[model samples]
Every structure is written in structure tokens, then in C-alpha cells.
Target chain A: MNKKINWQYAMMASAFLILALVPLFMSNNYYITILNQMVINMIVVFGLNFITGLAGQMNLGTAGIYALGAYTSALLSRNFGLSPWLTMVAALVVGFLIGRGLGYPSLKMKGVYLSLTTLAFSEIIRILATNLMDITGGTQGIKNIPRFRVLFWNLDTNVKYFYFVWTVAVLLCLLSMRIAHSKWGREFKAVKDNVEAIESLGLDIKKIKIRAFTLAAVYGALGGALYAHFNQFVTSLSFTTDLSISYVIMLMIGGIGNILGNIIGAIVITILPEMLRFLGDYYQITFCTMVLLCAVFLPNGLVSLPGRFRHLVKKKGKGGERFGQ
Target chain B: MEKKRYLSITLAMCLALSALAGCGGGQTPQPSQTQAAGNTKEESQQAGTAGESSNDTAEGASGETILIGVSGSITGAAPINGLRTKQGAQMAADEINEAGGVLGRQIELFVADDGGAQDTAINAANLIISQDVVAQVGPNLSGMALAVEGLLSQAKVPMLTGATSPKLVTTIDNPYLFRIRAADTVQAKLAATYATQNLGCRKLGLFTNSNDYGSGALNVIQEYLDGIGTAYVAEAHNTGDTDMTSQILKLKDAGVDGVIIWTDDAETALAARQFHDLGLDVPIIGSPSISTPQVSGLCQPQWLDNWYCVTDFTASNTSDHVTKFVKDFEAKYNETPELYAATYYGSIYILKDAIERAGTTESDALLKALNETDNLQGVVGKYKPNTMREMVHEGIICKLEDGTAVYLDSITVED
Candidate 1:
């Protein structure tokens, strides 16, 4: 068992090493830009995985959290002329508090009802951002957001941005993995699978669920803050319900309950519609069809497919004379 | 099984990447691509011994293929403007190409939809610049134009807009940015002067849309009014907002003899109808953008009585080019070309002429040609580049009589 754990650790480290090196070989500015977007999406999805995957909470208001984080960071940096790094920290803290507040309401509801409430919350936030023109620039959107350096790296180029976002994504993923495997993570699973049993054992199931959601919100908010800086702009359109749904799709497609799944899903979904651009107007329709087909056939999602396939191949090799091979 | 999974993943990735690449409106070639292609052509020209300095000749020859990029709301709320703009551009391009093309090469058009959104307009501008198009047209709305102007200025690509708002040019003008139409200030001054002089309208009330297009026109009118020491009552409404009873009530209360409206849709006609219904029998003077057939169609006969509007183009006008365009457009679309179409048509021609004059499709040369423009005849009127403060210069004021627009004298406003 210890040896098996060591192998798992080695694989995780190597996977991260590969992620860290992706920007080195990227060809053009456009590709690097897209990759940077994917990395930011990965961080957001990883946070979402905690809420939807671990705690079995269906919060469609992830985009609202993202917008809050983005607006908080941007307004702080732009209006107050504060350091953006400090603003990002502030955004995360605010996100954490808001998430806890929102999670409190969810304790009274569950399933689709909870999902609807979250969806309404996101919609409300989006509408407020749009209508409050004096402060939020209304529908014209906030522009000319100051670009900041990520850590010690100069993000003057897309290549630099690729490395910056990737580094953050990996670090967040590592943290998520550590939390996912911890005792609290097991409690989260307990709450998700059987809340009654968890409570019967005198465990604070509501506390676990709220903390998990709060943690996820923190992840989404930080990701949003990073995105606001990365793109150097934020509009109400960026944080619509469509974005939240897209994040859900990413989580589902990549394989819920796993960090690597979130990353893979983010990359797949992010790049999929972009690739469909050749189809012109028809691309969106085709993308929707593909997504529906995936949902129907691959119930466990795309992330687990490789591992499942490997398992199948090993089983087949043991059973037969390897006729196909 | 692992191999198959890998193959599927690879295929999926491949399909997605290709689709994204395909979404690009055109082959936006890099600067390196252009320079390399220029070198090969220059080498061939050098062998022919034209002696016009291959560099200069190459630049001129390259300019022959006039590239005009148009961006507008193609798939969203304002798809009509985008589609009509493209049609207008295509018509002009066809004419230029038929008449042996500009500078002996075919005119090419690259178009992208702004999605009726500001951010999309910025993206479209970047896309056009990347494609190395010499000049731009349309992006009809003021908000879209403002968002794109920054990128066009950065890329040094000349944008010949049809958007008439004066504020659209608020950013510092480089030699690269030029307008074919007169600004809203010019139109507002003309409308104000015409009202006070020709129509004997005094104590006017102004109604305009709440957006940049409407509000911008209102500002210009206010400035003109301030200049003339004329006091007027003003009210604003959204583009598609149907109710104007409150506005009409206010106008009635103000006891204004004439009401000037700045609108781009049937809402203007609706306002007129609402005005008549509310028993306010006042002469309405409207901005150029208010003269769409859709407006006339919505509020006709009684509603349109004594309605005056300033427009760059009139469907009834009998200029040779205008006549030909109307006939062709009528046959194709089964409707007369609106003023927006005419403006778009003119923009394409103006860009083509500038490209030919510059003798290079490069943005810098095209921009110079656009800036130094003077006395170029278009379907709308004569385009004097040096004097053009906006997309239009001299808007002809016309009055609606029996569902037909009767052209009055051209109103050219002083600065």
C-alpha cells in the first residue's frame, strides 16, 4: 500500500512537471494566449470540483463568485490604486465570506432546488453588474485594466503569461489534491453520499459541506481575480450563467472528483468550440451535439477514459493470447 | 484499447484546433508573410527593368488589390445593418472590379460580425488588422466604432466610418483615421440652422435615444443651440422602447413648435404616432439615422406628416450611380436600398479610390490617401477627405410627403 502511494505521488509530480513546461514549446502568441486561458479555467474548475464533486453541491453561481472576485480585485486596484497582488488576496477573503454566507442558505435546500437558487444568485449578480453603470461602467464594460506581473516573471508576452498561469494552476491543483485526500475530504464524501449517517456518527456534516463550498468559492474567486488581470478587462458577459454552465460541463467532461480530470476537462471544453470555428455558424450546433453525445455515452466523463481503457487492455492481455496486438 | 483512446483524444484535439483556426474570418497573414511575398514580386519586377525603384513599384503594385475590411453586427440585434453593409460593399466592389478593378487588380472584401457587442467589435478590429486590410468601413454603431478605433489606430489602419456621431472622433486623430461622412456636429448645426431659418421653428424640443448614437446627436444639437442662444427642452429614450407618451407629454408641456428626434429605428416613427395620438400636432425634425423605411412603414400617412430628416442618401435621388445601385438592389433584395446601405456603398468606393491613389494596400499608404482625400464623387455626394469631419460631410435634408422623401437643398454646416 505504501509503495502504491509512492507510485501515485511520483505520477502526480511528473504530471505537474509536464504542465509547467508546456509554454516552452508553444509556437505563436495566439496558441500561448489560448493555453493561458485554459490554465485559468483549470484553477476555477478545480475549485468547482470540491463543491459539485466532493460535497455534491450544485452551485451554478460559480460565475457570480468569479465576477465578484474579478470586480473586487479590479475595483481595488483601479480605484484605490492598491497593489493588485494584495487586492487578489482581499478578493479571495471576500469570496470565502460570501461563499460561507451563500452556503448557509443551501443547508435548508438540496438537489435541483439548491441549483435553481444558485443560478438565480448568479443571474442577479450579472444583472446588477450590468445595470449599475455609474460604478461598474454599465453595459460598456470596464476597460484599460492594469496588467500586472505574475510573481517574479514579466508577463509582457503570451509565452510569459502561459508560464505564469500554468504555475498557478499546478500549485492550486496540488493544494486541491492534498485537501481531496485528507480526513476532511473523507468527511465531505461522507456528507455527499450519506449526510444522515455522517450526522448519526456525531460529525458536523453541515460544517463540512459549508467549508467545502467556501473553499471552492475561494478557488473560483482567485481564478477570477487572476483572469481579470490576465485579460486586463471584465464585463458582465464574462460572468454570465453561460460561463457557470460551461464550467459545469468542463467538470463533467473531465471526470468529477479528480484534480487531473478538472484540468483535462477545462482544456477539452475550452479548445473544442474554438476548433469548431471553421464550421462558421454551424460550429456551435455541432459542439452542443458532441457534448450531448459525450454525456450520453461516457457517463463517468472523458478524464477516466484513459485509465479505464488501460485497465481493460491489461485485463484483455491476461485473458487472451493478445490476438489484436 | 489504450492506443485507440490516444487516437480518439488526438482526433478530438485535431478537430477542435482546426475548427478554431477556421473561425478566423480570413487568412490574417503576418507582416513577415507580406514582406516575403513582396520580395519575390520585387525580384521579378527588377528583372523587367521598370526602373521605378522596385520598392516603390512593389508597394504601388501591391496596393492595386484594394482590401476593404468591414465590421458590424452580423448575427445579433443589428444584423440588418451588417448584412446591408456587406451587400452595399459587394455592389461597390463588383462595380470597381467590373470597371477593370482598382489599379488593375481585383478589390477584396473581408467582413466579420461585431455580434452587436463592444468587445466583439474590438476583436473584429484586431482580426481585420491581422488580415492586413488597408482600410475599414461600417461598424455602424458609435459604441462599436469607439471600441475598434483604438485597435485601428494602433495598427495604423484607416477606418472610413458611416457612424455620424461627433464623439466617435474624441480620441486624438492620427493621419491614419479618416471619415467619409460628416460628424453629428455638422448635422446638428445644419438641422438647427435649417429649423431657425428655413422652417421658422423656434423654442424647439429635442427627443433622442439614450445610447451613444442618440445622446451624441443630442449633445451636438445642444451645442448648436447654445451657440445660437436657443433654449430647447430635451428627452431621451432607449432604441426599441415603444412608449413615448411621457416624452410627448413633456414636449406638449414645453409648448415647443418643433421637435427634433435622434433615433436609428422604428421607435422614431412610433414616437411620431404617439405624438399624433397624444394630440401634439408639431412638425418633427429628425437626425439622418431616423429615415429608415422601417420607420416610415411603422408610422405612415398621418403619423409621418410634416416629418423632416437629414440623410446622406435618399432612395429617390437620381444620381447615375445611385440609380444603378437602387435598380440592382431592388432586383436582388426586392426592396429599395436604405440610407445605411447607401452610406456603406459609398464607404467601399471611397476606400477603393484611396487604395488606388496610395498605390499600396499597406495600411500606412492607404491611411495617407484617405486623409489627403478631396473632391471624390460618391453615390451620396462629393467626398472631400480634407473637409470630412465624420463619416459624412453634407447631409441633404428631406421632408416626407405621401410616403415619399422629397429632397430639399443640401445643408452643409459650418464648424
Candidate 2:
């Protein structure tokens, strides 16, 4: 078991090392932008995995929180001329407050009802963003958003933005990994598995759920702020329910409770469509078919593939035991 | 144990099959590439095959190819428009290649579908740009265009799009981006000009969808109306709203002489039907979508009588260039082309012209050539890049007569 754990750690380290050297291998601005986008998406999905995968809460309001963060940061940076870094902090606070406020009331409900409330929350945000023309720029959207700058070094180029985004993504991944192994992570799992038992064990279940939601919101807000600055534009159209669904799908495909799974899911989902672009009209169809196949075949997600393969190999080796069974 | 092995094999088979399918999809463009090569061979034969073969071999040795990227929603909510744009672009590319290509090198088009979503568009832009395209053509929707504008600008790849948002050319102000279609403000002003000056309507009414596209047009029309000191009543309806009775009734009560409807094809049709059913007989002027076949097919044929629209293209135009484009497009695509197809077709020709004039695919050179574009005739109108990089300035007003949009007058904004 110790050897296996070390091997897994080694694999993770190598994977990250390769990711860090990606820019060196592929210096094209376009690929770097895609990588940057994928990293930003991973950050948001990491936060989402905490709520949906660990706490077992069906939070579908991620896009709403993301939009809130993006708009807040964009408005601040555009109007008050705040630094992108400062705007990210402001967005996180706003997201945390909104997430806690919404989570507290909705946590009392379960399953579909909770999902519906969150969906409504997202829809409300979208509608407000569309209707509030003066504040949100209506449909024209907020443009010319300032990029992240540190005294002469502007994070304007794709390569520079890639480093900035990946650094944040790696730090957040570490934070999420810590949370997943901590006592709070266990409490989250307990709430997901058996809420009544968790409550009986003298734990504040509502508080645990709210904390999970708040953390998810903070990550989402951070991701959104990074995205707004990186893209240098924000439109309400970017924050639709379709995006929220994509995040949920990524979390599911990656394996809900696994941090590594989230990273894998983000990479595959973000890059697959791009790779399939040569398919012309059949691009979306092929992407959807592949995703469906993954869902149907890998019930526990892609993370379980190696274990399943190993189980198969072991079973094949034990011929006499198979005959006896 | 047998079950585990079986499941493992099944999963492996699925992965392998998907991998094959992905590769198959990636190779879909290879057939087109070969066709382009075959065309070049024929052209070489016409230009003295002996001498051409030597030049071709020399060129092949150098392995020079100029790639231009085309991005649009080829398979999503607005697939028809996207496909039309793609078809137009592809036709332009084929023609350019047949004419011995651009700058003594074949033009290779890298087309990608954006699926009409912001995220997908970004990916499409990234994918095309990764292939090292000299410039890009589309991502037809306004929202998708806005999303990828920054990426293209950063990469220093000039793009010409048919997306009609005024902000696409003005507010964002990406130096590398140019718009082929008239902006929404231009269309709105045209509608305003036609309704007030031609129809002689004093009190105008506005019926706008509450979404970005509709509201954006509404704001622009209001601005134009305000500049002319015209009084008007305005009401907005949300998307997925089938009922416009309340809004129509409000406009009727306001005693407006004409109603300017700003919405998509289906919604515009619905609003016009509702207005007719409500016995409001005012002259109806709408955005370009109101002139589409989809709208005409949806609304009562009689309801469309005398309805006017401000559009960038109408097949009824008698200009030799427009006639030629209509003839060629119909012969090629086996269907009458719409605004998007015409505008995108024009965009490619404009790009080809720019590339030819610049004499190189360098970004700065192409941008300069594009900025200096003057009186370049297209199916739509005379092309010229203004200070804002808006290539098309004039809009055509078309009237619906017996389910067909008839070109009535051309409206041009003074420089």
C-alpha cells in the first residue's frame, strides 16, 4: 500500500511537471490560450467537485456564481480602475456571501427540490444580467476589461497568462487536496452518505454544507475573475445554464470525489471538442457520443479505469479459481 | 472474475472505437484538400504542364501554403446560418485556388464549428489559430464573435465577420478585427430613416425583444429617433414569449403610426401576426431578420404585405454584381443565399483582395491593406473600411410583397 501510494504521487508529480513544460514544447499563442482556458476551467470544476462530489450537494448555481464574480471584477476593474488581483478578492467575498446565503436556505431541502432552487438562482442571475442594461451593458456586454498587470509586466500574452492561470490552478488544486483529506472532508462525505447519522454524531450538518458551498463559490469566483481578465471581455451569454451543466458533467466524468479526476475531466472536456474540430458538422455529435460512452461504461468515472483493468488481469490469471467459482 | 474481464474488454473496445471515430473525423477535410490539389493540377495543365510541373515541383520543395481559418456555428442552434457562411467561404476558397491561388501559394482553409456557444467559439478560435492561420473569417453569431475577438486580436490575426453588433466594430475596438455586415445601429438608423422620412410617420412605436440583440437594436433606434426629435412608444417582450398581445395593445393605445419590431425571425413573425390580429394597421418596419424566409413562412402571407425591413442583402437588387453573386451562389449551393451567406461570401473576397494587395500574409501588411480598402464592389455594396474598420456602410430597405422581399431603396449613412 505504501509503495502504491508513492507510485501514485510520482505519477501526479510527473503529470504536473509535463503540464509545466507544455509551454516550452508548444510555444504557439493559440494552444497556450486553450491551455490557459482549460486551467481556469479546472479551477472552477475543482470548487464544484467540493460541493457536488464531496458534500453530495447538487449545486447547479455555479454559472450564476461565476457570472457574479466575473461581473463584479469586470465592473470594478472598468469603473474604479482596481487591479485585477484586488477585484478577484472582492469577487471572492461577494461569491462567499451569496453562496452561504443561498446554501443555508436550500440545504433544508433535498434532491430535486434543492436542484430546482439552485437552477432558479442561476436563471435569476442570467435574467438580471440581461435586463440590467445600464449596469451590465445589456447585450453589448462589458468590453475592454483590463488585463492583470504587475508594474510593467502585463499578463496580456497567452504564454504569460498561461503561467498566471496554471499557477493559480495548481495552488487551488493543492488547497482542494488538503480539504479532501481533512476532517471537514470526512464530514462532507458523511453528510453525502448519511445525513441523519452525521447529525446524530453531534455535527452541524447545515454548517458543513454551507462551508462546502462557500468554498466552491470562492473557487468559482476566482476562476471567473481570472477568466474575465484573461479574455478581457465579459458577456451574460457566457454564464448560461449550459456552462453550469458542462461543469457538472466534467465533475461527474472525472469522478466526483477524486481531485485528480477533476483535473483529468477538465482537460478532456476542454480539449476534446478542439481536437474534433476537423470533423466539420459532425464535431458536436462525435464529442457528445464519446462523452455518453464514457458515462455509460465508466460508472465510477475515468479514475476507476486502471483499477478495473487490474481486476480483469488478476481474474484472468486465476484460472483455477475462476473454474471453482 | 469473468464478468470483470468482460467489462474491461467492453470498455477497451469502446475507447478504441471512439479513438478511431475521432481520427476519422479529423480526416474529413483530407478529401477537400485532395480536390484542391486536383484543381491545381488542372490549372497547371492549362498553363503549360511542362513548365508548370517544374515550378510546381520547386514550390512543393519549398512546401509553402497560406492557411486561412473559418469559424462558425456549423452544427448547433443556428446551424443553417453557420453552414451557409461555411459554404460561402469554401466557395470563395475554391475560386481563389482555381485562379492559381494567392501570392503563388495555395490557400488552405481551416474551418471549425463553434456550435454557437461562447465557450465553443473560444475553442474554435484557439484550434484554428493553433494551425497558424494568416487570418480568420467568422463565428457568425454576435456573442460568439465577441467572445473570440480578444483571442484573435492577441494573436494578431485579422478577422472579418458578419456579426451585426455595433460594439463588434466600435466598442471593443480590436485593431485586427473588421466587420463585413452593417452594424445594428446602421440598420436601426436605416429603419428609422425609412419609417419617418419615406412613410411620413410622426409617432413611431417600438416592439423589441428583451434580449441583447433586440434591446441593442431598440437602444440604437431610440437614439436615432431622439436625434430627429421624434416621439415614440416602446415595449419589450422576453424570449420564448409567444404572446405579444399586451405589448401590441400598449403600442396601439399609445396611438403610434408605425411599429419597429426588433427580434429574431420567429419572434418577429409572431409579433407581426399578433399586431395584425389586434387590428393595429400601422406600417411595420423591422430588423433584417423580418425579411427572412423563416419569418415569411411563419406569418400569415397577407400580414407581410407592405412590411419593410432594413437588411444588408436582398436578392431583388438589380446591380450586376448582386445578380452575378445570386446566380453563382444558386448554381453552386443549389439554393438562394441569404444575408449571412452573401455577407460571408463578400468577406472572403475582401480577404482575398487584401491578401493580393498586401503581397504577403504578414499580419501588419494585411491589416494595412484591409484599412485602405476603397470602393471594392461586392454583392452587398461598395466595400470600404471606415476609421472603425466597418467594411460595409449602406443598408437596403426591402418590402415584403406576396411572401417575397422586394428591394425598395438603398440607404447610406453620410461619412
Candidate 3:
């Protein structure tokens, strides 16, 4: 078992090493931008892996959390000339506040109702962002938002921003992995498995749920803050229910409750649409079809491909050879 | 434990890396794939709106095809503008190609659908820039236009816009962004002056969109109104709002004799119809949207009574180029072209003329040629680059009579 755990850690390290190394070879600014986007997405998905993936609660208010985080950071740095580093801390605090504020009331609702409540929350945020032009800049959005500075080195170029965000993403990933593998993670899954048993065991279910939500919110906000600095602009149009749903999709497509799955899912979903652009107008439809197929055929996600392949090989070796590979 | 799981996952990463390489490998004969797909795909329901999304590289061309990029919100909020942008650009490209191509090479336009979303617009801008377009047109929504302006300027590719927001030029000072349509300031000033001077309106009521495009214009209109020492009541509404009775009632209670509205297509029509229904019995002057076919078509003749608007192009104009453009456009697309189509169509020609004059599609040369552009007659009035990069300096103010827009005056400002 100890050897197995060592292998798992080694595997994760190699996957991350590859991600960290790819940007060096990528000379294209567009690809670098896409890479930065993937990093942000992975960070968001890692947080989401806790609440929706592990705890089995639906959260469709991620857009609101992301928007709040983005606006909080963008306004502070652009308007008040605050350091982006400090603004990011503010964003994290904002996320924590939202998680507690939103989580306290809606965590009690089961399934679809929770989704609707969260959805309403996000919609209200978007509407307010759009209607409140004086502060939020309405549809025009806050532009030329300042980049992050690391001890006098500004992350102005996409490459520099790529490394900065990737660093953040990696640290967030390790923290998320630790929590996912910890005792609290087991308890969260236990809640998903049997809430009655959790209640009977004297575990405070609400507290556990809120803790998971708070972690997810913090991670999500951090990701949003990273995005604001990297893009150098923040618009209300970026925050929509479609964005929230895509985060859920990334989590589901990667494999629920898995850190590596979050990374893989974020990378694939983020890069797939760009790769499919040659398909022309059918590209959006084709991308959707591919995702739907992945969901239908590989219910456990792209992370399950190896296990499924091994099972296929074992079955074929044991006289199921008539079935084609 | 599946020990080989690590190997398979690593292989997946390899596949993804290779895919990323393929995506970034721009201008490596990939456009042909798009052309083939666009040809084979079933006809989309939104006909002609597909306008210039993809283009075929014509065989037997003299030199390499000059690629021009066009992008707009085809499938998002305000799709009409995007579709029109594409159609106008497509029509112009087709015309130039038929007229023996520009600079002895066929023009193939690459259009990206921004979906009116900020993230997608940036992606679209980067996609087209990677394809090495000499110039770009559209990205018509003002907020969207502003979002991608920095990207265009960084790439050194000049952008001729269909968006009329004055901030595109004023706020950013981006040298690459050239506003092909008359700025909203022009429209607001004209609307204000016409409502007050021609219509004998005083103590007017104002309606502005609660967006950057409308809100900024509100300040301009207010400044103008204040300069003239005119008293007015103003109200703002969101982009997708259909009912504005509450705001309209406020205007009514203010006892204003005339109304001036600065808004987009649907809202302009909605406000006009509401005014007619509520029996406001006031003369109204609106922004360019009020004159667009999309808005005017939505209204009855009765609703159009006493309504006036300032627009870049009017199908009723007797100008030979304008009429020829309208006739050719309607014949080709089977739809009437309006604000977006006219400006984007004219912008294509303007960029084409610059490309020809520069004798190379090189960014700096083409940009210089665009900057020095003056007195070039196209579909939308005359093209002349100004200090503020405002391309079309003149707007025609038209009055609606019996649901037909009658050209009343042409207001050309040198500034």
C-alpha cells in the first residue's frame, strides 16, 4: 500500500511537470493565452471538486463567486491603485464571505432547489453588474486592468502571466489534493454516501458542507483573481451561467473527487474547442458531441481510460477474443 | 491496481500536446479544411448571417490571397448586428473579387463569431490575428469592440469598426482602432439639435441605454443640452428591456415637448411603439438604431409618426453609390442592409483601397495608408480619417413618414 501511494505521487508529479514545461516550447502568444486560461480553469475545477464532486451538492452560483472575485480585485487594483497581490488576498476574503453567506441558507436544500437558488444568486449578481454602470462600468466593463507584480517584476506578457498563474494553480492543486485525501475528505464522501449515518454518528453535516463550500469558493475566487490580472481586463460578459455549468462539466468530465482529473478535464475542455475550430461553424456542435460522447461512454471520465483499457485487455486475454479491440 | 494507468494517462497528455501544436500552427493550409467543412455543412437556418464566417481561396489567383479578418457576435446578444456585419463584409469581398480581385489577389475573409461575450471576443481576436490578417472589420458591439481593441493594436493590425461608440476612440486612444460609423456623439448632437431646432422642441425628455454606448452618449447629450441651456428629464434602460413604461411616464410627467433616445435596434422600436401607445403626442429624435430596418420594420406606420433619427446610410438617399449598394446588397442577401451592413461594407472597401495603395499587406504600411485615407467615397458617405480616428464624419438625419424614412438633412461636421 505504501509503494502504491508512492507511485500515485510520482504519477501526479510527472503530469504536473509536463504542464509546467509545455509553455517553454509554446512560442505563440495565442496558445500561451489559452494555456493561462486552462490554468485558471483547473484551479476553479479543483475547488469545485470538493463541494459538487465530493460532497454531492450542486453549485450553479460559481459565476457569481467568480464575478465578485474578479470585480473585487479589478476595481481595487485599477481604481484604488492597490497592489494586485493585496487585491488577490481581498478576493480570497470576498470568496470566503460569499461561501459562508450563500452556503448557510442554501446548503439545507437538496438537489435541484439548491441549484436554482445558486443560479438565482448568480443571475442577480450578473444583472446587478450589468445595471449598476456607475460602479461596475456596466456592459463596457473595466479595461486595462493592471497585471500582477512579483517583487518589481511585472507579469505584463502572456508568458510571464502564464508562469505566475501556473504557480498559483499548482499550489492550489496541492492544497486541494491534501484536503481531498484527508480525513475530512472521507467524511465529505461519507455524507454523499449516507447522510443519515453521518447524522447518527454525531458529525455536524451542515458544518462539513459549509467547510467544503468555503474551500471551493476560496479556490474559485483565487482563480478569478488570477484571471483578472492575466487578461488585464474584466467584463461582466465573462460571468454567466454557461461559465458555471462549464466548471461543473470540467469536474464531471475529469472524474469526481480526483485532483488529477480536474487538471486533465480543464486542459482537454479548454483546448478542445480551439483544436476543433477547423471544423468551421460545426465546431461548436462537434465539440459538444465529443463531450456528450465522453460522458456517455466514459462515465468515470478521461481519468478512467487506463483502468477501462486494462479491464478490456484482461477480458480479451481470458477468451473474450471474439470482441474486437 | 492498474499499473499501466500512468502510461495511458501520459499518452493522453502527449495527444493533447500534439493537438495544441496543431491549433497554434496557423496558416499551414488549415483554412482549406474550414472551406471544405463550410461547403459540406448543411445550410444553416440563419441564412446570409453566415455571410463571411468562412471564405474559399479561389484558384488561379495572381498572387497570394489577402486575408482580412471579421468578427462579431453572431450567436449571442444583438446577433442582428453581427450577422449584418458578416453580410456586409462578405458582400464587399464578393464584389471586389468579381471586379478582378484587389491588388491582383483574391480576398479571403476569416470571420470569427465572438458570441457577444468578452472571453470569446478575445479568443476570436487572437485567432484571426494568428491567421495574419492585414486588417479587420466588425466586432460591432461597443463594449466588445473596446475589449478587443488592445489586442488589435498589439498585433499592429488596423481595425475598422461597425461600432459607433465614441469611447472606442476617445477613452483608449488606440491608434489601430478606426471608427467607420459616425460616433454616438454625432448622433446625439444631431438628435439634440434637430429635436430642438427643426422640430421646434424645447424642454426635451431623454432616453438612453443603460450601457457604455448609451450611458456615455447621455453625458454628451447632457453637455450639449447644458451648453444650449435646455431643460430636460433623462431615463436609462438595460439592453434587453422590452417595457420602459416607468421611465416613459417620468418623461411625460416632466412635461417635455420632445423626446431624444440613444439606444440600439430593438429598444428603439420598443420605445417608439410605447410612445405611440401611451399617446405621448411628442416628436421624437433617436440614434441610428431608430432608422435601422430591423427597428423600423418592427413598427407600424402610426407608431413612426413624428419620429426622426440620424443614420450613416439611408436606402432612400439619392447618392448613386448608396443606392447601388442597397440594390446590390438586397439582391444578394435577400434582406435590406442597415447600419451595421452599410458601415462594415464600406469599411471593407476602405481597407481594400488602403491595401492597394500601400502595395503590400504589411501592417505598418497598411496602417499608414489607412491613417492618410481622405475623401474616399464608398457606400456610407465619404471616408476621411480624423484626429479622433472617426472615419465617417457625416450622418443623414431622416424623418419617418408613413413608415418610410424620408431624408431631411445631411449634417457633416469637420471636427
Q: Which is the leading candidate under DockQ?
A: 3
The window of 10 residues in a row where model 3 chain A has the poorest summed lDDT is A3-12
Query: What are the root-mean-square deviations of the candidates from the true structure over C-alphas?
Result: 7.7, 5.9, 4.4
C-alpha displacement of A307 in model 1, angstroms? 6.7
Residue B229 CA error for candidate 1 (Å)? 7.3
> How far in Å is the alpha carbon of B99 misplaced in model 3?
3.0
Among all windows of ten consecutive residues in candidate 3 chain B, which has the lowest summed lDDT?
A: B40-49
Q: What is the interface RMSD of candidate 2, in Å?
A: 7.2
Give DockQ: model 3: 0.44
Query: How many clashes show up per model?
Result: 15, 0, 0
DockQ of each candidate, alpha-carbon based: 0.16, 0.22, 0.44
Q: Show where candidate 3 strays beyond 4 Å.
A: A1-15, A293-299, A308-325, B1-63, B269-273, B297-305, B401-406
lDDT of 2 by residue, A262-322 (tens): 8778877876766765455666778889989999999778877877898988988897687
- Which is superior by TM-score, 1 or 3? 3
Between candidates 1 and 2, the one scoring higher on TM-score is 2
Full ranking by lDDT: 3, 2, 1
Question: Which pairs clash in model 2?
Answer: none
Best by lDDT: 3
Stretches off by above 4 angstroms in model 2 are A1-8, A149-153, A320-325, B1-65, B103-105, B227-229, B239-242, B276-279, B294-303
Of 1 and 3, which scores higher on lDDT? 3
